[model samples]
Target chain A: MMEEHKVIVELKQIATRFGDNIVHEKLDLKILEGERVALVGGSGTGKSVLLSEIAMLREPDSGEIELFGEPITQMSGRELLAQRQKIGMMFQQGALFSSLTVLENIMLPIREHQHISGSLLKDLAMLKLRLTGLPEHAAHLYPQSLSGGMLKRAAVSRALALDPPLLLLDEPTAGLDPAGAAAFDDMLLELHAALNLTLILVTHDLDSIWTVTNQVAFLGERRVLMKQPIEKMVKDTHPVIEAYFANERAKRAIRQELI
Target chain B: MNEEKQPPVISESSDGVQLRGEWTTPYLKQLQKISKNNTRHQVNHIAIAQLDPNGSRVLLELIGNEPSAWPEGLTKEQRGLLELVREKVGPVPAQQESVNLLAALGQQVFRVIRHGRELLEFAGQLSALVFSLIRHPRQLKIKMLLDVLQRDGLNAVPIIALLAFLLGAVIAFQGGLQLATYGANIFVVELISLIMLRELAPLICAIIVAGRSGSAFAAQLATMQMNQEVLALKSLGQDPFAWLVLPKLLGLMIVMPLLTVLSMLTGIGGGMFVAMVQLDLSPVEFIQRFGAVVDPIHFWVGLIKAPVFALIIVNVGCMQGLLAKGGAEAVGHRTTRSVVQSIFLVIIVDALFSILFAQLGW
Candidate 1:
């Protein structure tokens, strides 16, 4: 089944660094179409940095990135922009523009990329807002006025406005309460199923990993130590992966797994 | 993924209308125009080659929200997407209510009154903190005070000197022309010294400081308020006013008089240069006349207003900052208001000082 699907993102021998501090080295991973993958690691392991690299906001120090089966280094600026329009990235802190209303924030990307007019643009933005479980009233309020959960949902709505097939999230559930996190996980799964999106999210929440992601890419030392389903990843004896999941949450998940 | 696909198109059919092609966002740009122009057909069926959520939404909008209008032969994924978008199609947000003129005027009046009240409360709280800190002076943040002094005071010297010198030169050249024509070129020294020491120096310095340090204080505190840094300091049992607001107020108070003195010296020096070059008066003669004719009372009168201007500037800046409510836009708005209000208040206070000094026969 994996072979049948196309590879959406391929990173080969990727390396990133800041001065003397090395974050990723010789990191190689392939995310297939319609797969929900999570990049999980300890702090400073550069999960967010890797997501940024994939989004083409930042270039790696070395190695090649193949986004949608084309090498990014060789693409022209216009081609890069065209390819980038197919990818939507949501930053960790709901990086919504504070000045624009939530509805306008969602409409901005679509307006820049498409030539749709006034009523159609608003209707499209409103549709995306509803799809992310945001209420109608939220569309008129500024991002600063919304609560934490609503802000995250609003950010996701803006990301989905352009209907990008690939959606990247950074810490989507980090600050949410337990119930909100669970609901967000369900929303992600539903969106993935309905929109057929290939998702790559950077997160540390084990519950979100189990509920939303089908593949877990564990970062350790300076590379992806393993890539497998969460059920299998929890059983791995690798010291880094074991140390990461040693908390009580992992134990409860394992006991409750029924496997 | 970068490959270009067929743009969405609506074709006329006997039954209704047919949407054909990849109905994705990038491709739907053209379909909007086509759909708007097609008046003859009711969109009854959508048999698109490819469909995303955006495409499904456009299709659902084209056909009214009737489930019966869902075309046949839609793949399960496509059907699920259409249903999801259609189910969530809520009414557009309501337009803002139109406010009547009398109510708006009343709101404006109430807003000004509330603003004044809040400013008074903040001023009271700040004064209470200052009084308590005086008894335990060791509690004062010496390091932050020094930092603010270096940034808001020492860093502002160059621009202040340049403006003061230019203003003095303009006054001397203009005054010397009139004084020279009357064969009283020596009185240019009295004119320059009196105005520079008593009015122009202090007023120019205060205006510059209000634009510079006042705006900075407001923007810095407003950004902190936005990021919850002020709240964090409060939660830690530390008074944000004491730590954040007091340093700026005290630093500006300490530096305003020093900057005014610098302004007076540069302005007088500029006047002295113009007198020697343009009025044919020597520096020694100009200094002698300045000391004999310009009373020492003028200098004191100007110096006495520095701290008051500082007080006005710091209070307005910190008040606007602490009251900021939103995000980046609020920070910008508050900072602009801080500068404008400080300058306005400084000029009004200066005028009041002039009247009081005249009545007192200073």
Candidate 2:
């Protein structure tokens, strides 16, 4: 799979900082096409910051980021916008616009990028909603009306509105019951397969790590400590990686994976 | 870093253009010049080697959509580098057009009209809510109504009374000084009573409510908005206007008239004190003179404007609050806006009422 797949995202020497707090320093990563990558880190490791940078919502303090073989730093404003349109981002809080209905939220990006009429836009938005497995009645309701699980699914529907090849999720299953989290992971896998999307998610859920992602990028000490298959990552001897998977829950998850 | 060792070279051939070396921001001007000069020819090929993100962007700009083939003799690493460049470099920037001042002015006017339309629409919604409650009294939230009345009206009495009393004392003092020169100090009762009852009492009370209750209304709604409670209400299929805004509006309207009557009496009492201490007038004499000069028409005229001012204050405050968005900063902004707009509109409506009454020969 690695040999046949194309490189979709490349980060060379990325450095991110807020005032005196440096989150990432000289961080390098490469994400292959159609791969499911999970970024795991302790608090303040800048996993979300890295995800935002990849989404092109924020520029890294320093370093080069290339998307689909093109360097993003040198692209013109219009080019940058075009590149961003090809990538979908789902925020941690499911940042659906409060003023818009769920269907309208999905239609927003589609309408912004296309010159289609209102009816067709609504149809497309409804189709995306259906793809996310939301009930037909959920389309007319505002985001605040939905349950947390439904809200996340609505956000995912909106992210997939334009059918972008790349999808970035920040803490996709941060707040959920175990059953809901497992279901969300399954939905993610289903969506990835159905859309042929390259998914990069930031999460701290050990179960999510084992279930959803093929590769795990452990972030610590202001950089990605390792990027490898989750199986290889489980056996990694690095101190930070060792500490992370040393917990009883992690051990159980690893045992389950091995079984 | 490897590209830094070998500088990029741009050469034009019969078939196409070939770019080699580290293409970056520093060499952008040279690339621009080359592209500008070669615009006349149909460049069919763009070959890129050892290019960075910036270099790739410049090359993409230079090549436009005319490139027919990739760079020849490129290694796999170089091919990856070229692909990265191609991905980074997007379509050329659209030409900048000059701004038209008339069109800009037209847009500003259109925005103002839209704002006015929205305000009118909000007023209509509040009116509908009020009518709906009147028709179905059972639907009214009596508890919320009483709560707002307690908060906005009952709590406001002491401050409003004190302010009105002070205002009346100052008017009497000022009028007494002028009347003393003419040896017509006895007429000071008429002057204080007329001004207090006809204009000052209701106007002062309205302004106080606008500042106190109006600002409170805005801040309360804004906090609810920030907390997503307003959104929660909408999600629950509850009418925010009826549940939140109507009660405040009705409460203020009911309270304003009561507050006005209190203001009038206190203002007269204040004038009596000033008249007794400074003008050598007894309380009995002042009351006798006041009873003769002050008419019901003057009190009614002032009291009639209270509900209108109440409507303006509550509407402006609630409208501003509902418009609040974002976080704490936005709540603060809408609260401030509510007070300012409520006060401004209250004064404007007060002036219009004065004009209307004066025209009617009142």
Candidate 3:
């Protein structure tokens, strides 16, 4: 995928505090269109909060969020939603609508975001499901019946249903077996290749960072520790990043656990 | 220190890794079991200690390979649970043979009532939560209602119908047997009519709705609570009550009455079928007698109770769901509480109605 210099989302001096507990402070990042950046950190380091704020799921008390060259912090409810539609997000737990069949899950983005008819939405949903290596029959079946991997794939399919320019995945490979995680990685790569999606993945899964993502960002201590190529990230000398990479458990188990 | 020196030489079965790892060999079985049990026990102790930190004096290592392995929010809570485990277990030895089941049951019953009191109070306070959410309708609220009601309320219809059918059958069979003995088979019509229209119809329907939808409501809100979606909505200048609670309350308020009528109609239909075929009554006479005997006032009374039952079901369901703490287990627990409380409240409301209507010369 060709990297676009166009900054689709930019966070400048972002800070979020939950009462006395300050999650992130003065976090800064520029996500270029068609850039695949994996945000990695400790659990309490506010990776999800960073992603949520950018996604307009949360608003920082201070700092600015610009999506598609528009100031997101200034955008109202209707406008934020309009921006959300253009950006696809795969929730940490797959977050497939439990009420919906896999087909319906995919169709939801279409139903909410566009003017497509139900049948056409179904066809589009099936097509997206296929791209994730899921069969069309998986479409009609509800989420509870699905295996963890199948549910993630269905969510991925749904995320792509609206043909979003930017796709944000929160721990895309978590709760999956190795084969499932690997398969998910392949599916992500395939989607990136096929759609040229500007991907922002918030994950602590180092394996995913190394194997799947192109760029990596580390968030911690109220700031972005680093944002650069994955290769450069692993080679960086930051103590927190070093401690993370040095942890033996991370090498063997943390990838699967964190995903 | 020699025991801890090997870093707990626990090894996974290389082959068993492909499956859920139940594979065992006789030679190494004891070692595996020892390590596995020890690991689980240690984990439990640590988690329990986190829930109730004073339970264990020995500090366990905070043993996550990475930050993601453990819940960040649960450390303090885990300490509290551990400390309470000692409190919960009491000083009584487990080997005691003369343990009183009733006493145990009584303690559980007492705790439940105590818990239930706070819950009912919370149910009353839900309108305040609703009022705060009215100014803004956030996505989280939208998602919660849409998921809970659609996933639970709509999907649970078949099971509710089945339960109503079975309740009707049981009543018809028992009523038929008693009436047969008295040589008053015709009076079974009046009995069935009275019990079902006035009491069983609403009671059974309320129970079914609570069991099915109440639990779902608790789980959905609980998960949202866990994720801070409720907080997120508030931060985004949206009010969760109007967005989430009001619509669901409205939807359930609408759906429950229709369901009550369905239950009443279905129960009667089931009874009528058994009456005609099993008891050898002519269909025309059964219909005419059923029509003649049923008071229009009973129908109104049944309709009237539906909203009250709805209030119980929706209120308890949503209330308990919102009250969910911790993870999936808390959700399940809350769901159970919601259903039980919903059913209890429904019956109590029904009884109050009965008392009031009786005193008013109904």
Candidate 4:
């Protein structure tokens, strides 16, 4: 099955450490084309760090990362940038440039990579904004003026500006109300289907894990403890996985069929 | 795919235009140019061998949905790509509004006035907090006060000493060169002493502190503000001014005069060292000459400006920090603003002191 599908990202024998504190050791994961994958872990389990590694924003201490079948280390600077343009990563806090309006923020990556005219670029950016479910007027407003939900959606619009094959989201539903999170999850599903994007999100939200992702990769003890479909992974006997899935809130979410 | 060499080709036919070659992001400029001339012309065929998502969107945007036409022998993959593009790229309503320069300028002026008013209000509140703290002495956090003093003052000494010493040496060396031509080498002591005591020492120390502690204060407070710790304090019913700003104010004020005195001594010592080496004057001779020519009034004049300079540095730093909003970038902006404002205000205050002292004939 893995051989049948094209692998978009492959991390092999990845090791990351800061001084004496090892975050990841000999970790390996492969994400196929158009897969919706979630990275879940405890507070210090380096889920976000792993996400950064996949995004090429950070380099592993020792390992190799291949994006679209091209080894990242082997690619020239221009080729590497071209590869990076195929992947869009949103930071935990939206990370929109505060100086630019929502429209300008979304247009930034597009303008950087594409040579379209200003008016057409604006139109393309507007299309992205509309796709993310943001109102037309939101394009004029700065990130600071937007609510938490709008900001996240705006960030999604910016990430989608280049129409990347892979989208990495760091805690997409964090700090959102349940309804807002659910709405965001629905938007993600719509975007995933429409754009044919491969998604890798690092999230602690149990509801998000169930609602958004098909596959969950649990990071613990300096490696991926399990990578399986969410349904099957919930029943896994791994100590950390068991504890995570057996949590009170997890149980509640499961009982409500919200996950 | 040698994208630069493969500039997208537009073939004009009797029916319509057929776009060939790779239609990717790099070729969007060429596509836009082609579209500009043929805006009225219908795109009857898209025979491009490759089309990325961005390229597909551009192509669909160029070819508006009309009485339909498709490329002959179009592959299923190409059709799928076109379909995706049609689904995503809808008619984009153009933004027509132009910027009004005069209105923008007016808004900027209003923003500046509002900022000035806010700064004045902050100063008033700070004064009130200080007055209340004086009345309720037990409310002051002595531990935090001491920590700030040690951090902002004692830790500043090494840098201050080095800068002051170097500046003094430069002044002495420069003065000695001019003085030596006139056989007035001894007067270099008077020049160095008077300048170091009355102006250079205090000015340099204040500027250094502004660069060091002022920027640090702004960055610290801005980060706290960004993290909502300041809001947390407000929610907890604790005045952040009393806990944070007042200690910085007090710590800086207390240390500035002391640092100024130390700066003066170090500067004079440096001048003496330079004079001994360059002018062939003994250390004893330099000291004696300095003591004789430099009056107590000059030292007092410089010392009197220290607390005022300190107040300016602390207030500007704290004000910038308090005004900071948003993220790490906001903190950096506030820090830069704090240093610039503190240095500007310190120089202005120093000039005012100079004028006042001259009027009083000090």
CA lDDT of each candidate? 0.88, 0.81, 0.68, 0.85
Could you give candidate 2's per-residue lDDT for residues A101-210 as a string of tens digits? 88889978877776544644565576668667787778878887788889999999899777677889999998988998898999899778655679999998988988
Number of the predicted model whose TM-score against the real structure is largest: 1
Give the per-residue Cα lDDT of candidate 1 at B263: 98
Q: Cα lDDT for residue B86, model 3?
A: 25
Q: What is the C-alpha RMSD of each candidate to the true structure, in Å?
A: 3.0, 11.5, 22.5, 4.5
**Predicted candidate 4 versus true structure: per-residue lDDT over A1-259, tens digit per residue:** 5543888889999999999999999999998988899999888889999999888889999999988887898888999888888888888899999999998999998898877778888777887888888888788888989999999999988987877889999999999999999999999998887667899999988878888899999999999988998888887888888888787446756677963
lDDT of 3 at B347: 84
After aligning candidate 4 to the native by TM-score, how far in Å is the CA of B320 from where it should be? 1.9
TM of each candidate vs. truth: 0.91, 0.53, 0.45, 0.82
Worst 10 residues of 3 chain B by lDDT: B49-58
Off by over 4 Å in 1: A1-4, A248-250, A253-259, B1-4, B12-17, B42-46, B98-102, B126-159, B181-184, B219-251, B324-333
* Candidate 1 global TM-score: 0.91
What order do you get sorting by DockQ, best first? 1, 4, 2, 3
lDDT of 2 by residue, B1-362 (tens): 11234455656676566655545333444545554566555444444444433344445545553333543555555455445434332222233455599988998999879877877888999888888888988767789999989998999999999999999999999999999899998998999999999889998998899889988899999999889999899999998887899889889989999999999999989999999998988999999987887778998999998998899888888988888876566778888888887778778888898899899988
The stretch of ten residues in a row with the least summed lDDT in candidate 1 chain B is: B38-47
The candidates' DockQ values read 0.73, 0.06, 0.02, 0.40
> Of the native A-B interface contacts, what share survives in model 2?
0.00
Which residue pairs of candidate 4 clash? none
- Looking at model 4 chain B, report the run of 10 residues with the lowest lDDT sum: B65-74
Which candidate do you rate higher for lDDT, 1 or 4? Answer: 1
In candidate 4, residue A221 scores what lDDT?
Answer: 91
lDDT of 1 at B82: 82
Q: What is the interface RMSD of candidate 2, in Å?
A: 16.0
Worst 10 residues of 1 chain A by lDDT: A246-255
Give the Å error, residue B292, model 1. 3.0
